[model samples]
Target: MKKYNRIKLWEGLHSSYWFVPLLITGAAIALAFFMLTLDSTGKSGLMEKSGLKIYTGGADSALTLLSTIASSMITVAGTVFSVTLVALTLASQQFGPRVLRNFMQDIRFKFVLGTFIATFIYCLLVLRSVHTDAEQPFVPKISITVAILLAIASILVLIYFIHHASTSIHAWHIIREISDELESNIDYVFSENPGNSHPEHKRQLVEEITTGFEQQAYPILATGSGYIRAIDYDRLMNIAKSKDLLLHLKHRPGKFIVRGSKLVRVFPFERGNGKLTKEINYAFILGRERTAFQDVEFSIKQLVEIAIRAISPAVNDPFTAIRCIDQLSVALCHLTQREFPSPYWYDDNDQLRLIADQVTFAALVDDAFHQIRQYGRQEVAVTIRLLETIATIAEYTRNKNNYVALLRHANMIRRGSENLFEKLDREDVEAQYQVVLQRLAKI
Candidate 1:
């Protein structure tokens, strides 16, 4: 449960727009105090005597400089905010709303906003310390000098932000970024399991574990409603181990559950009491929306959304759709070579502890291409690209099931395109389909 909480906290911080900037703001405040302390302790005089260049202004000049920088920074900060909104709006209108999360999670964007706002606050703090009314008028020369440096740094950040914001909204850039995320998700989802079940043994093991348990199993109901963002498998295994129980997970991450729905099924019906039910529920983390943390399909859906939008009648951008297909194919190719984790989890004594839903190549392939195929039916280029991608993925796997999934999608693409395409278009798509057939046959 502690692990699950940590995952939630880290995900929250990653998705937050304010957390990073707030930290930067705090650092700026600390820097202001440190520089003021240096001036108050006569460190600025010592630096000047040592031939180090510093602010040489009296109290009035220091106040004016700080105030001008402060006001200008505030104005520029407003402009930065507006620019960020414009970029987000353009992304939402052009791409899907899911892409906005990527923009929000961007460290570069946060740093840019933080730098400008921090500079504004720094100048204001430094300006407040400048005094001209006393006989011994005081000026925090070091702090003002640091403020000047910060203002210069903020200007450079502004220039880079403009460039980054402009390029980030391009279709290929967004697609590639999502593609990279998909690859990372694939790696994380598949690489964590302790062992991979062989094809010959997986079915036998599942049958042995599940035989006759359905009639006697007690269902654990969900207490809340939301997507299953994550589940602590270690916690579930520990609970099952300690209680001498058999647990079957009813759903996996990326699945949605409503209140009172069957969440897990426990064997030996009488063992599932209120205390045990609460412990089981604690292992599953529900959220208002799905995340890519343990859900590989979440990222796959992001790519599919882009491809669907690109090939929509309103957009008619086949090249962008092709780009998405290429990226998905790269991820599928990587997936084909990896062994999938077995759903049957056992304890150290080799006793079955939990049965969970396994992520398979077939499901992933469908998740990546299903909606795009449905939406891109009328587009011959997209159909051909999908077949080409499937063919490319087929080259990486010798598994019969993987070949079957790839071949099935290829045939589906051909069938979907037959009536929609003209003569030449139909020929092109059919040719690609045949290439996929030949590729798989060779494998």
Candidate 2:
């Protein structure tokens, strides 16, 4: 079904149509029982002269007649209740927030009221049937007060059950919805924002990037040489087309290529001047290309927002987090050249950028850590702390300047973490930290 129709179905179930019928049925059942008591005693009591006369279809038998009517009504109500209960359970499982809430709320409330009326009426019916064996006759010294009290208690329990069921089903609906959305968006979610809470969001990292490596390249030296002729991209395209390279590879717009390297291979059809223009700053482009990190370009704003969410209570601290990730992204923004994979190529600046990025990422984790304490999730806290340690290790290894700047955030977040991650192995983080500290000592 369409989402809106499902929502409509939710509305219908919660609508006055179903509710009115349920309430009417409960009242009818309760009334039938009330009528049954009156008929069982009133007509029978009037007919009784001295003692009780026991006969099935004899005497002015109003009791006998209402019970027969009540029996059929109760049977029908029971079947209807059972079927509606099943339908309610199924609909609650298959839908979203608004729909599920409607289903759970209406059905639960109706059932509660129905059950109380049904059970209480049946109890009254049973009470009306009691009699003494040897001496006394069927005597119901029916206290109006006690009967009313019993009815009230039964109704109260029904209300409580309805409330509790509604609450539980609402929680269930959210968990399922979150889990489904997580499955679809999880990869993009993790790739873009590594600082996000994985398991709490109902997913874990698929490929964990453990010990990172940096591939360095030295800038070429030239004593201001004469410029070369602009190479025609049309001719290059023809050559590339013949080799079927355009089909095989995906290339970025600007590439700083070696003299012997093929610039492009393509299926040819191109214009003249715009296709091949000699870029004077090719050497600088090459220098920038060798140190690039990111390949794709998109907004980092969302990730920044996520960082803020993770560390919300302690600080609205979005700027610090955004700056750190922005630092990392700046290094990435330069990787527009299509060559090696991201995270491999970088200069010393990129290394420090990586450190700054990791530090900011870890600091945002402070919010998650603080929440772990605030919310009392020891298991999630442990997972987040493990990721924290891993990130700290990664950041600490980057460079001295970034290390000195970021590790100072330790004082800010050190309060809650003292006893929390105590059982987790610190060697991974400590070893990496020492490696950075040692590198910093040399500088």
Best by lDDT: 1
TM-score of 2: 0.22
lDDT of 1 by residue, 321-348 (tens): 8888898889889988988888888787
Per residue, candidate 2 scores C-alpha lDDT tens digits across 331-393 of 322221112222221122221111111213333334223333343222333323433443444
Please give the clash total of every predicted structure, in order: 0, 3
- TM per prediction: 0.97, 0.22
Q: Which stretches of candidate 2 lie over 4 Å from their true place?
A: 1-11, 14-21, 24-30, 33-106, 109-152, 155-443
Q: Summing lDDT over every window of 10 consecutive residues in candidate 2, give the lowest-scoring window.
A: 350-359
lDDT of every predicted structure (CA atoms) = 0.87, 0.36
After the best TM-score superposition of candidate 2, give how far the Cα of residue 407 lies from its true spot, in angstroms: 29
In candidate 1, residue 203 scores what lDDT? 69
lDDT score, residue 296, model 1? 86
